[model samples]
Target chain A: MDFTYDDEQEALRDAVRGLVGKAYHDYEQRRQAVKEDPGFSEQQWARLAEMGVLGLPFAEEDGGVGAGPTEIGIVCQELGRTIAPEPFLASVVLAGGLVSAAGTPEQRAEVLGALAAGERLLAFAHDEPGRRWGASAEQVTASADGDSWSLTGVKEPVPHGARADLLVVSAALPEGGTGLFLVQPDADGVTREGYATYDGGRAAKVAFDGAAATPLGEAGLDVTASIATVQDITRVMAGNQALGAMQTLLKATTDYLKTRKQFGVTLNTFQALNFRAADMYTSLELTHSLVAWATMVIAAGDPDEVAEAAARASLQVSRGGRHVGQEAIQLHGGIAMTAEYSVGMFVAHLTALDHLLGDGNHQVRVLSTKVADYDALDPLDV
Target chain B: MIEGRELTKEQIVEAQQTLNAAGLAVPHWPEEYGGRGWTDLQRHIWLEELQRAGVPTPLAFNASMIGPVIAHFGTEEQKKEFLPKTANLDIWWSQGFSEPDAGSDLASLRTTAVKDGDDWVVNGQKAWTTLGQFGDWIFTLVRTDPDVKKQAGISMLLIDMTSPGLEVRPVQLIDGSYEVNEVWFDDVRVPADNLVGELNGGWTIAKFLLGNERVGVAPVGSTKRILARAKDLAKETSDGEGGTLLDDPLVRARIVELENELLALELTALRVVAHSADGEPHPASSVLKLKGTELQQAVSELMVDLAGPASVASGAGDASDLAEWARISTPTYLNLRKASIYGGSNEIQRQIISRTILGL
Candidate 1:
């Protein structure tokens, strides 16, 4: 029932907000200078790592700041304010999450420490040429030669693949099961062809032709469960980013409304249009609460709760976040349509986040089946 | 109004038993005075389950508009007679909010009921009275003082639907649904003791009802259900003369865009619900209403677009038994046209935001 963030979480928000304000006040310039660039600047990434921001969510046993989910939520929120080109989720969340979930002691040391130090960038190599997300995997083959495993198959839409030093690959086992393997980008028979995605992120189509790889943990580790953990992080972190993006979009549009004079009056003075802006602000806040709650549940290590929370979070971020982005862009008029404006950065990222894995539509389908029938029982139970 | 979603017989019995168990059966009633002590979220859980299962909110005319007004303003003796039965749906209630002459200009309602010995003889016609066909009783607003300006001197009265000279005729809307009604009260007799609240104060109560009604109308869960149908349907059929509808960039883009919009609104709804202080509604609730309704319509349009010609009819020649979808879309789309107009039109909402929320 308690909804307020603790003091540390508030401080985390203030700190990240300050950093984002200074570094990303104007994202359009950042996007242009870094367009199709390999990755986030090492200096900036190292600075964030040094600050312990990159390890906000990992336990203390690993090389993380040991901050709770709320703290990580704050970092994601600030990163979202700017169209942060850093693969925060792809590396820290997705890859780090897999290692944390299924990695042996040695695997955790090799991958997580570098990630916590921000010395290496990693990408998740799941979602092959399969028809939909979280279904059957068509790519990333795993065949065993003795106890050693070799992988072959292409992983498309690999976020940050071009810059990744480590790639967490989901491999299909010969025994009619699937598991994850830690593959090096420079491994033999592995080729990363780069492309720039619409959301201003560098992605790659990675073809692994019998590439040498090492299993992070036991062969046939639960990929779905591991990915669920990653998805829990992804949903909450994505929600955080969406919250920040919507806030920026709303603020920018609010400024536009105050200044953009038409029919001899500021747009704010017009009830006919100002209502939509007010609505955008309201929706932004609503989505924020849902994401905030999800962060808490994930941090608390409640997977069932996380599942419900993820569904709800995805529901809001993909649904409400999209509305605020659209209205904010539309309210900004022609300026928002052009790439030169920062609002476009927010719009593209919001849309990209909306479609990644699935949009609200897909989330609804996923969320509903989990509970085929709701027995209208006591609300306290939920 | 009975929103076309039907209830199962067992559910109807459950509803009756649940209501009968409560000392005060009014779903909208505040927690005190024998009502269910539920928060807005809990109440919403009830409504969500019902709608997601295609069960309408327990009798809206009673729970939403009338019963709350009576509970708030009724005399003790009036409560004794009306509140209990209204809660139990023992007496089906209908609202007399809009007349043909004052659909949107609700404050300008011309219905009149003059004072009489121990009784008020009402003579007026009300239109778009949802579910007037089943109304055993009605709560109406009458212009008691013509000398006063519009929105002033209106009195709230409780009248038995079967009173002398009262008539209810169903109005079939363009959706081919019999939800609304045209009710004529030709000098009908309503006991003076039946007036729930003070004269000239009905406008205040009516406004409060509008506020309470805002919480559930966004229908986020139901819209989720609709979007689910579209996604399922698109996966089966092609986007007309194409490889597949989902492969059709144009349709896919629209669905994705609408899905995103719907997600944003659902978050907005949760945020608004979370931000609500006490049980009282906020000006921001109006914001949820506006966006939520818009997204509902947009999702409906996508359902139709995804279904294409299949969406137009109730059935398909192939295994395309998208009957639930085909049956729902056109009506749902037509029903959503009022999104901009109801609970104080979106234009009015903007005014509230500009003047009330922003102090501009």
Candidate 2:
């Protein structure tokens, strides 16, 4: 029932805030970092690894810190506050998560150990071209030759795919269901084309033409369920991150209103503009509550409830992000429309996060199918 | 008692007394004053469960509004006289705050209570005294000093509704219900001892009571119940095709969106309750009232849409072939419009957020 962070959680938050805040406090620093090839600061990423944040979710036996989702969510929120151009969500929470969920002990130690040590980058190459977000892989098919498997398909918009050392790809199996595989980015028959995203982040169009791949865990096991669960978890974490960004945008809007003047008075003196800021605050607070609850639901470890909670939180974050983002630009007038300003970039990053797993419409569609399954949604019971 | 308006005064009192007997009617109050001394979360769960069970809550005037103000600011004699009776529903209290010219701007109310030796002669009118027809007493804010600030010149006086020179005239609402009244006082005398707090200090008590009103004003539990019922009704409804209304993507999407919003609100309420044990309402409590009422009205609107043409039969009787839910849908929807209007209008809530929270 408690929503406030614990003393230890607060300490973790302060630590991460200190690190990212120092690096991205000035908007120019984030803009300069995103201009580079990797789209983020390598030193800061290494510092996060040194802080054990990159390994916060994996088991210690798998060469990680073994922290719960709340702690991981804290780091995500901190990164979101500054709109840090890091691949933490793409690399650690998504790709590293897939390995921890579907990979064997040996593979987990190898992939996640290197990832946690900041020696390797992994990207989950699950999203393919001409397909809506789903757990099954239709275009990407896997062929098994004796004990080895090779993948043949195109996985476009593979987040951080070019910078990744290993690709955790999902492919349709010969029998049924989706199978998880690990492919080397420079493996034979693999093509990687990377470009900057609208949010000043990086993603790549990865093509696999009979690229040699290793099974994540068992050779022919169906990891479709695992893929869906990990995606759900990532969706919730993305919500946490968006909550942070919305918080900053709201503050920025309010701070601007109190100082920015037009026709001889500050913007706050205008009820019309101030009320919109109030609504943005409403959106941010609601999103914060939903994200916090969803994170706790994950920490509560109820697999059956995770998907629904994730979709609910994602819908709220999506709507809230758009409301706050657009209002921020509208309230600030012309300045927020500029590329150099951090507010618009924050909005762009929120849009990227919304489309990453599923946007508001997609989530509502998913939820609409089961609208009659329950009489009412009880947050506590979940 | 569906919607609670159909219940007689005796039935309402009996139900509340039954709850009071179990210490469930006023669990939010202090332990010495017939309260269970439950935490805010516990009281919240109690409310949600009561709503889900379709039990009519203790009268808001007695349980949520005036009862709390009395317990917080009343003298020992006043507390000893009214606290038990209020909790047990022995005294049906009505709120006499709003006037014709002072709805949102309540501090501008002209109701005056002049000191007349041991009695206060009260005059002026109070509008929108909901359920005043059943009131045994009324808690009022009246001007005791006309020279100072509009807010500062006010004082609270407890007046017996049966007193001479007092009249209650029912005001018909658009819903065709007699749920509210305009109370007039022409030199009605209230005992000087009936004053709940100090003279010219009613504004502070009014604010305190209003804040408490906002805390539970969301009605999250009952709104959830009605929405759940609406879904069942939608399933039984026709969409002009060979399928039920629930089969329509538009209807389903609408319900899904509302359900998601409700879940967010419920979670927000939980967060506020978790932090509100310190006695000061959480700043985010304003969101509860603003968003809560919007969702409540939205759910009611969904029902009328589900009923479609049948919603026009709001006047249908028991013998009518129209579905019971369909016949009542439009009126229920109309009645719920008051939700956003009361407990401080949604616009006032936005003002609070912009000024108090966002500091805009």
Candidate 3:
């Protein structure tokens, strides 16, 4: 029920902010970082690992810090504030989370240990071409060859797939449901085509031609539900990230409105623009409430509730992100449209986050089917 | 007895008494004044349940508007005189803050109250005096000094509705409801002791009262009830297909989007209430007003749209074959347009956010 972070969480935020903010406070610094191949600073990644952020969500026995959802949310938020192009969300929260969720004891100790130590980067190569956002994979199929398993299909737009040292792949099993597999970058029959994304990040068209893979936890067992739960957790974390991005966009817009002069005065002197900014603030706060609530729901540890909370938070973030992002550009006029400006990149990042898990329409469509199941939503129900 | 019927004033008063007897009428007030000393969240649940169950909430002016202000700012003698009566609905209250020229710029009100020997002579017109016809007393904001700033020169006065030269004239609304009125005072005399707070200090009290108004003004519970009802209406309605209007993807999508927005708003209200547990209303309470009213009006619009052509039959009598809900849909929709306009127009809310919260 409490939304304010405790002192320890505040310290964690300050620490992450200090690190990321120092690295990317200047727009050009971030630009230079994204201009290269790895798409993010390796030193920064190692620094986050050194700070134990990359281990925030895993078990201590698996070489992690074993922090709760709130702490992880704070880290994601700080990273989002700077729009740091690192794969903390894609690697640590998503791919690492899948491994932590479905990996066997031995597997967790090895893969997550290396991930936490910053020895490896991971990607969840689940998304496929012509498919909308979902929990289970379709194009990718897993075949059981007596004692081993291999995956064959394409996982296009696999976030950071080419750069990832390890891949947590979701594939449809020959028998029935989806299963999680661990594939190495150099595994046989693996081809990765990495490219720059709209939001100054990397995704690859990874084609697995019967790629040698090991099961995440139990061999040939369906892990669809685990994958879905992990995705829900990732969605809530993404909401936290979007909340941070919107906060910065709002501040940047307000700062611009105060300094940018036209019509013989600053832009804020016009009530028309001020009112729009006010609406943007309203959007940000409302979305913030939902995102924070969803994070709390995740902490509460009910998968069903987490699923619902994630959808609600994702919807609000999508709508709010669009409003604040678009208005941030409009209020700043043409400057925000330039690549050199931080506001446009923040907007681009917000848009990317919006479409990452599920957009507003997607969330609403999922929600509409169950609208009749309840008379009204009660946030305090938990 | 009041569930489905058009409640008479006496019935409304009796309902408040029923709630007041249970100490549910003014749970936001101090415990000494019949309040339950409930948390904001509990009070929220109380309000939502009342709306969902079709129970008439305590009259806003008596229970929410002036009662809390009086309990907080009234002198011991004033509280002793009015608090019990206000809580029990023995004295129906009406608001007298708005003037024709002071609609949004409320501080510019021209109403004047001059000090007399043992009384104050009040003279001015107050517009938008809601439910004024039933008012046994009126809480007024009047100009007490011409030399000071408009806001600084104002004071709140508790005036008896029967005071000499005081008149209430009903103003029919677009929805054909005689809910609002214009109250005029021609040198009406009020006992000096009837002043609620310090003289020329009403602006602060006015702000406190207005802030209280906006805090609970979102109508989250009622809007939610109406939206749930809209879903039902959509189900019963035929789309000229094998299925009902609920079968329409667009209808369901609209309902879903509105439901999601309402969910967000409800959660926002909870967040606001939680933060306001310290007694001062949270600044983000403005979001509740702005978004709350928009959703309220939006749901009403959805009801009208669901009623379709039958919505035009708002004047239909009991003898008509059209569903009662359909006959009333358009009128309800038209009436709710005032949701955003009243309780400090949504525009004023944006202004509050821009100036106070955002520092824009």
Candidate 4:
């Protein structure tokens, strides 16, 4: 009911923003400079890990912050705003969450400490090359020969898969079901062809080819709940990031409009451009509230509510993401279309968030199916 | 075309019992007077859930326009006499503000009432009275003074629809529906106690009621249903080209644009509803009504366009390429032609925004 962010969450977000603020100025330039190896600075990663951010969602026994999704959302959103070339989303958020959710004590001892101490990075090697983004895992295998098991398939487009120290891979079983297996990145027969992801986070076309792997977590496990949790967290954090970048873009555009004179008047003084800015500003305002609501829904831990809220949040964000980026470029005129301008950077981040997981269309389809169910159940004409 | 209209007697009874059961029948009434004693959000949720459920739009006469006006501005005996029946729908009410001459400029209404005795005998015609033929009563504005400017002299009254010499006749429209009527009060007798608020202050009550009628009139769910139908028609209709009518670049663009607006309007409505507890008549109603009406009209137009030659085919909406699909769209479009005009024209909304929001 209380839609406003609390003091603790706000201060935590401000701290992350401060750190990222100092680290990035020309995000596009930094994005262009980064190669396929390490995405963000190791020193920065160490600073974040040392600040107890990477450990924010883990239990006290796991050498972590013991905070909830709100704190993680802070870091995720801040990183997204800068479009910081980093594995934070991959290592700190997704992989870290999965491991914390299902990993054994021995596994947590090895991975969580390395992650909390900034010694290791992990990737959730779940999404495949051709499937629509869902929890139907078809990436690897788990063959338990009495005592030992190993994985035997490819996990492509694994975010930072080449550089991640650990991989939590989801695989369909030979018998009938799905289980998440943990694999060390340097395992034998694990061949990863690396590439620089467009958003500047590293990804790879990985070929497992019967790689040696360690079995993790219990069997007959439903990762559906966990995967949805991850996606919702990802979505809200992505929205937060988009919020920051959009606000920055808005501020920059507002400033530009005030000073950039045309036809003997400033750009904003013109009705056509003014109306466009007003519309973008309206979208941003709505997206801001919807994202906040999504955070509340995710924090509440109801899957259907999370999906509906996230779908709605994505709908608003999808529109805002495109509108703000495009209008920023449109308002900035030719300089915006050029790579040299900040507007293009916002455009890059926006486009990335737009298509990430599945765009507005995918979420809307999910939402509409449920909405139809709701219609059928209640038969409310509305 | 719309087939026919029928008085929803069962619907009226159901709405009353349901509201009473939910304890939502009373809001502004005192607890001693049977009010819900609920918060603003609770009141809003009640309204929203009812609308979303499509039980029936709460009779504006009983719930919004008259009952609250009476509760706020009526005397105790007046309250004791009217509030209970209004709540129970013992007396169905109709609005008697709009005239044959005045629509949005309600204050300029030429209907005049002169004081004669312990009662006021009224002589005036009220046009576009929705369900007026079925109404048991009405609340009207009559010009009480002539020298004063247009808005100053109007007085509000509760006039019996069945009063002697009152005439109610239907105005058959192009949509083939008789939901509205022109009510003529031929020297009708109404008690002096029927006067609400002060003598010549009906303008305030009319404004209040108009504001009440418009708060969330966007009808998002119904529009969602309509747009869904349009999407189907667009996909189905053949444009006599290599593809369907949907493949027409302009048609697709329009659909996308309208859908985007619907999304925007929805978010806007959510924000308004979310913060609706702040004790204000939200300024965004101007935005919502503006966008909602425009989008509703656009959807109707899109339906007609997608129906194409079937829109004017040999058997439009009858055993043709369109079937019953075109019937709903045609009447719906004709009926929606008033959306922009009724809840204050979208142009009026723009003026409101220009003055209030934009500071123009």
Chain B TM-score in each of the candidates: 0.86, 0.97, 0.96, 0.84
Global Cα lDDT for candidate 3: 0.89
User: Using TM-score as the measure, which candidate wins?
Assistant: 2
> How high is the CA lDDT of each candidate model?
0.73, 0.91, 0.89, 0.71
Ranking by DockQ: 2, 3, 1, 4
Model 4 chain A lowest lDDT segment of ten:
A373-382
Candidate 3 lDDT over residue span B26-83, tens digit each = 9988888878777777787788788767788899888878888998899999999999
Top candidate by lDDT: 2
- Show the lowest summed lDDT stretch of 10 residues, model 2 chain B: B1-10
* Per-prediction tally of clashes: 11, 0, 0, 1
Q: For residues A230-308, write the lDDT of model 1, one tens digit per residue.
A: 7767877888888888888877887788888888988887665677777676676667756876776776676776776
CAPRI verdict (incorrect, acceptable, medium, high) for model 4: incorrect
Which CAPRI quality tier does the interface of model 1 achieve?
incorrect
- Model 3 DockQ class: medium
Estimated TM-score per prediction? 0.72, 0.98, 0.97, 0.71
Q: Candidate 4, B133: how far from true, in Å?
A: 5.1
DockQ of each: 0.14, 0.86, 0.67, 0.10
RMSD of 4: 7.0
Candidate 2 residues A1-382, lDDT tens each?
Answer: 5688899999999999999999999999999999978999999999999999998999999999999989999999999999998899999999999999999999999999999999999999988889999988989999999988999999989989899899999999999989999999889989999999999999999999999999999987888889999999999999989988988999899999999988999999999998898889888888999999999899887777999899999999999999999999999999999989889999999999999999999999999989988888888787
Give model 3's DockQ, 2 decimals. 0.67
lDDT of 2 by residue, B294-347 (tens): 999999899888888998997878889888888888888899899888878989
RMSD values, in order shown: 7.0, 1.3, 1.8, 7.0
Error of 2 at A239 (Å): 0.4
